[model samples]
Target chain A: MQLLNNRSAQLRAPGKRVSRARVAVVRAAKTADGPRVAIVGVTGAVGQEFLTVLKERNFPYSDLKLLASARSAGQKQEFEGHTYTVQELTENSFKDVDIALFSAGGSISKKFGPVAVKDGAIVVDNSSAYRMTEGVPLVIPEVNPEAMSHIKVGKGGAIIANPNCSTIIALMAVTPLHRLATVKRMCVSTYQAASGAGAAAMEELRQQTRDVLDGKPAQPKIFPLQYAFNLFSHNSGMDVELGYNEEEMKLVKETRKIWSFPSVRITATCVRVPVMRAHAESINLEFENDISEAAALEALAAFPGVSIINDRQNNRFPTPLDATTKDNVFVGRVRRDISRDDNKGLDLFVCGDQIKKGAALNAVQIAELLLK
Target chain B: MQLLNNRSAQLRAPGKRVSRARVAVVRAAKTADGPRVAIVGVTGAVGQEFLTVLKERNFPYSDLKLLASARSAGQKQEFEGHTYTVQELTENSFKDVDIALFSAGGSISKKFGPVAVKDGAIVVDNSSAYRMTEGVPLVIPEVNPEAMSHIKVGKGGAIIANPNCSTIIALMAVTPLHRLATVKRMCVSTYQAASGAGAAAMEELRQQTRDVLDGKPAQPKIFPLQYAFNLFSHNSGMDVELGYNEEEMKLVKETRKIWSFPSVRITATCVRVPVMRAHAESINLEFENDISEAAALEALAAFPGVSIINDRQNNRFPTPLDATTKDNVFVGRVRRDISRDDNKGLDLFVCGDQIKKGAALNAVQIAELLLK
Candidate 1:
C-alpha cells in the first residue's frame, strides 16, 4: 500500500509518471477478459446514485467492489438486490479493478484518483477534481462521446470527468441547437433541486418542510439557511469581480468545454429551490444567425436524448414533475426571444432529473461506452 | 340598473363598458369626520388578505362595508371583532360609500367598478381593469404616491388601478434603485404563488399537494396543468408574433410604466409555482453607469418598503417563507450581473407576499392615501 501511494504521488506531478504497479494491474484485468469495477466514496450522494444507475442499466461487470472512507467501511448496501459490504479505500483499492467510479469530494478525488488510475482502473470521476485537467476528457455521453476515446487502458488508466449538474441540464437543451446554429451567447437562471446539494441537504429540506407544516421552528443543519419553501443564490461566496458564484462559473466553464465552443459566452444565475429532485432552467440564447421558432423546435425534436414538450395551445410544457425520475432532458416553452434581434434568438425552459441525466445516468452512459 | 349601465357606456369606450346593476351597499355608522369604506370581493383570497392589512394599518374609517358575489352574500366576517355581512354588489350599492376597494376579477371590475365610481365613491381597483386608462392612476403607493392625486372627489369618482401581482413584487425591489441610477434593461423570472390565481387556484394547489403526498392522481382545475411539485410557463395563450403570454408581457409593461421608464427594455418569464402565498423573482438588471454591489446594496438598504436580507456569509437571504405574510418585499442574493458590464449591472432575488404587496396590501395602501 505504501508503495502504491508513492507511485500515486509521483503521478500527481504536472508531468505524467509511469507506474509499473498500475500497468501490472491493468494487464492482469485485461488478461482475465472480464471487467473489474470499483466505486470510490461509495457512501456519498452521487456515489449511491451511481450504484443505482449501474444496476438499473445492467452494466457489464464480472467483479464489483464498493470503496469508501474508513468511517463508512463495513456498511452494507444492496445493488441489484445483492448486498455488498463497503471496504475502506486504501492505496491499493484499485489493484484489480478495470473501471472506477469516483464521486467523493474534489480533494479526495484529486489525491486518490490518479493513484487508482495508475493502479490500472479507468476513472469516471463525478467531481471537479480533474475536469479542467488539460489532457483529461470531461465527457457527457449524449453530447461528447468522442471524448471517451482518450481513455487509456493499461499505461496509467485514463480519467473521464462529468460536468456540473446545472451545466448538464442547461446544455442538454441547447447543445443540439448549437450544433445547428452557432450559439454565441446564453443567459440562464437555474432552479436547482435540494438533492443537488447531496443527501444531507435533501434530508434538511424534508425536515424543514415537516417543521414548517407542523408549526415547529425550522432548524436548518445541512444547508447554511432554511430550505423550506425558499430559494437562494447558489452557495458560492460572493465574487467581487463578476458577481458570479463558483457554481455559476462552473456552469459557464463546463458548458463551454462540453460544447467545444471556447468563444461562446455564457452567464448563469444558479438558484437553490425547495424542490427535492429535478432541476429547472430558464434560458435565453442569442445565436449568430436567424433560427425560426419552427426550425428550432424541429431541430430540438430531432436531437437524441432531448424531448420537446412545447404545446402552447394546450398550456403544456416541460416541468420538473414531468422530468422527475426520467433520464431524458425535457425542453419546452420554446419561443423566439423577442428581447433579442429578430429571428436570431430564442428562449426556452428546460427541466431534467439532476440525479439522473445530470449525474448517475450520465455516468452509466459513459460506462456503457466501455462495452462498445 | 339599465339606465346606470347606459350612462357608464356613454362615458367609456365600447369595450370598456362597466356591467350593470351590481353595487356594494354600505351601512353608514356615524363618526365625527372619518370617511365610510367598503371592500368588494371580501370573501376571496385578496379580499381576506385586505381585511388583515386594513386592521393592522388601522386606517381611519367610520363605517366598513364588506361585499362579495351573490353566492357569498350574507356571509358574516369579523374584523377587529365587528361582524360585517357581505352584500351582493348592485348598481345602487355604493350610494353613501366614500371609498370602495375592488378586487374581483377583471370582468367583474370592468362591469361594476364604474357604477361604484358613478355613485360617488373612489375605487382602488386590484384588478387589471382600467389600468391603462389615461386618467386612471396605476398606483403602488411606494413608487407613485402622487398618482393618487388623480382620484376623483365626489360625483365623477376616480378609479386607481393596481399593477399586476408579479409586477408589483418585482418593481418594489427595483423602483428605489431605479430612482438612483437609470435602469436600462431588466430580465426577470417569477416564481409566482397559486394565490395569485385567486381562491380556487390556491385550493387546487393544496389539494394537488395532498394528492401527490398520498400517491393519488392530481387533477388541476384552476390551472390548465398539474400544480403539485411542478412549475409551468404563464398559461396565457401564445400571441401571433411569438411574444410571451399575457401574464409575462404584463410584468414587463407594468414594471416599465410604474417606474415611469417607458423606454426601459424589459423581458420577463412568469412561472406559476406550487407555493400558496408569496411570489419570488430572480431579477437581473443592467444600469446606465457603473453600479458597484456595495452601492446597490446601500441603495436597497436605504430604500423604504424594501428590506435587505442579503447576508451571504450566513446564507440568510430572502425566501418565500421569509416573505410570506410580510408587507415589505424581501430582497437578497444581491450580486453583480456577470452577463453585463460590471459597473452597470446588478442581480437580485426578491420575494413578497403576492396577495399582500402584490395586490391587497398595495390596494389598501392606496386607500390609506384616500383617507388622508
Candidate 2:
C-alpha cells in the first residue's frame, strides 16, 4: 500500500506526451495468472479513492495498471506495497486488463470506455457515461447485486455504471422502504459535500476556510463565489427547462434506473455545502400504498448496509459528521409527511460518505463481483 | 436610549408575585402623550431582537414596559436609552399599553395574550400562539402589508402573528412571483442557520466550530449533537401521522396562510446547517399556467425586496455568505423546474439573513404600520 500512503507523488504529467516504451513495459509486466486491474484516470478524486478501497478491502490483485490522460503519463502511484507507473490512456489501454475502474469525467469515459470494453476488460465506470444506456447496468451492490451477473465479457467487456452520489445515498434508505410500500413520488434536497466536486474543489474549500478564519481575502477559483460558510444550488450547469442542474438531473434519472421505476416522479434540489466529506439528503416520499412511520422505520432498520439513527427522543440521528469516514448510509428523523394525504407520505433524513458508498466502494464491490 | 443599549437587564421579580406598591409604580410610569409598548416575555431570543428592532427603528415611545414570567422578573433590560426593570407578566401587563410585542413560548402567549388584548393593547406576537387562530393575521410586511390594517385597538385589540423564519424568507421571493403567475405547488428544502434557534444555539455553533478546528472535544448543548461542519433535520421530534416535524409543518401552514392559498400543496424539508446567520432555501414551484424562465427572471428582477443573483456562466448566485448582514432576501439560480412539466415548473435558490428579514426587520416593519 506504499502508493496509497505516498500522498506527495505527482499524479499528473506536466504536459501531454505519451511514451510508447513505458506502455509496452507496463503491459509486459502484467500477469495473466493473477488478478489484473486497470484504473482509468487514476489521478482524479474518485480514482484515488478507488486505490485506497482496493488496498483496504485487500482485493486480490497481482498486477495493477494506472491509466490516465496523456498529460498524466509518467506520474507514479503506489498501491499494495508496489509502486506503479502511470501510462497514458490510449485506445488499447485495457487490452489485457481483467478489470477497468473508470472515474474520469463523463466525456472521457464516453470517448474511451467502449474502447476498453472492446479490449476485453470488464468496465466499472463511475461517471454518468453509459448509466442510462438501454443495456448497461447501473448498479449499487447493496441494492442490485444480481444485476452484476448479467455482465457479458466474451464478445465485448460489460460496462457497469455506478449511480449518482446523491441518488445512491438517498436510494440506500428509500429502496428498503419502497419494498415495503411502492414509492410513488419522492422529493429530495441534497446537502452535498465539497469532495463530490473532485480534488481541486476540495482543496479550494480547505483554502477558503483557512483564509476566512485567518482574516485574509479568500478567492474562490473552483466555485463561483464563497463557499466557506454558505450553501448554494448544485454547480452543474442549469437545464434549459426544469431549472434543475445536471447534478439534480442525475439523481432523478439514476434513482429511476436503479430502482427500476421509470415512471416514478422524483423531484430534487441538489445543494452544495461547505462540508469536506459525506452528503446529506432531506427526503419526503409519497407511496402508492399507505404505510405508517413505525412500519417504515422497521423496514429501514432491517435493510442491509443501512443503519437506523432516528432516535429523536435522545436527539440522535444521522448527520454528515456521523457519516464521514464510514461506509454505511445513515437514515434517521423518521416521521410521517403530514402535508401528504393520511399516512401515505413519509419524511426521512439520510447521510453517507460520498467517496465510499457513493463512489470508490461501489466500484470496488463491482470488481469483487467479477471475481466471484 | 439607556434601555436600548442595556437590552439584557434582569427582570424585577422571580415569580408572578407583585406588590400592590409595585403595581402602583408601574401605573405612575405611564405617560399621557407617549405611546405605551408592552414587550411580552422580554427574556427570550425573538424578545431580545424586538428590543433591538425598537431601538434601531427608533420607535417613538413615551413609556416602555418589560414583561416576562415571574421566574424572569427582576431581570433588567435597556431600550432606547432607558434602563427598564422586568415586571412580572400577568393578565394585567398590557393595561393602557398601545401595542404589545409577544415572543414568549406559545403556551405563555396562549394564556396571557388574549388577556393583554382584553386590556386594550394591540398585540404583534412572535410565537406560533396566534398564527393559525381564525381572526389572527399572520403578517410579513412585504408580502401582506394590508394584514396590519386589520389590527384595531380596543376592539379586544387584535393580535397579529409573525410567520415562521423559513416561511417569511420563502414568501419574500415567492410572493412576488405568485402575484405575477398563480402558484400551484411548492417543494422547498431549507438550509437554516443556527441563529434561527436563538442566541444560545448560535453560541453553541461557534463553540463547536472552535472545538472541531482546534482538535478539542466538541459537545452538543443547544442542539442534540455537535453543530460544527454538519447538517441535520431541523425538527428532531416526529409527528404522529405525517413524519413531518413541527418546524416542517410550520413552513407548510405558514406559507399557505401568508399567501392566502388554502388549497395549494406544499412539501417542505427543513435542515439545520452549521452556518451562523443567513438561511438558504432550494425551491421548486409549479405555476397554474406555463411560464418561461426568462419571464420569471424579468418578473423577479422588477420585483421589490427581491434581488436576482443567478449568473451560471460565472458560477454566482445567492448564498448565506452573500445574504448575511443584508436586509432583503436574495434569490438566484432562477430557471424552469425541468423535473416537472416543461415551462410550467420553476426552480429557485433563495437566501436571506434569517435574524433580519426573517425576524427583527419584519417586526419593525409591522411596528411601522402602527405609526401609519
lDDT of 2 at B341: 48
* lDDT digits (tens) for residues A38-78 of candidate 2: 89989988889888887667676655778898899998775
Q: Give the per-residue lDDT digits (tens) of candidate 1, residues B29-91.
A: 223366668888999999998888877676666667788889999897855534466788888
Question: For candidate 1, what is the DockQ-based docking class?
Answer: acceptable
Most accurate candidate by TM-score: 1
Off by over 4 Å in 1: A1-34, A236-242, B1-31, B214-219, B237-243
Clashing pairs in 1: A22-A118, B19-B111, B21-B91, B22-B89, B22-B90, B23-B89, B23-B90, B24-B93, B290-B343, B291-B343
What DockQ, on C-alphas, does every prediction get? 0.34, 0.35
lDDT of 1: 0.78
Mark the 10 consecutive residues where model 1 chain B has the least summed lDDT.
B21-30
Q: By how many angstroms RMSD does model 2 differ from the true structure? A: 8.6
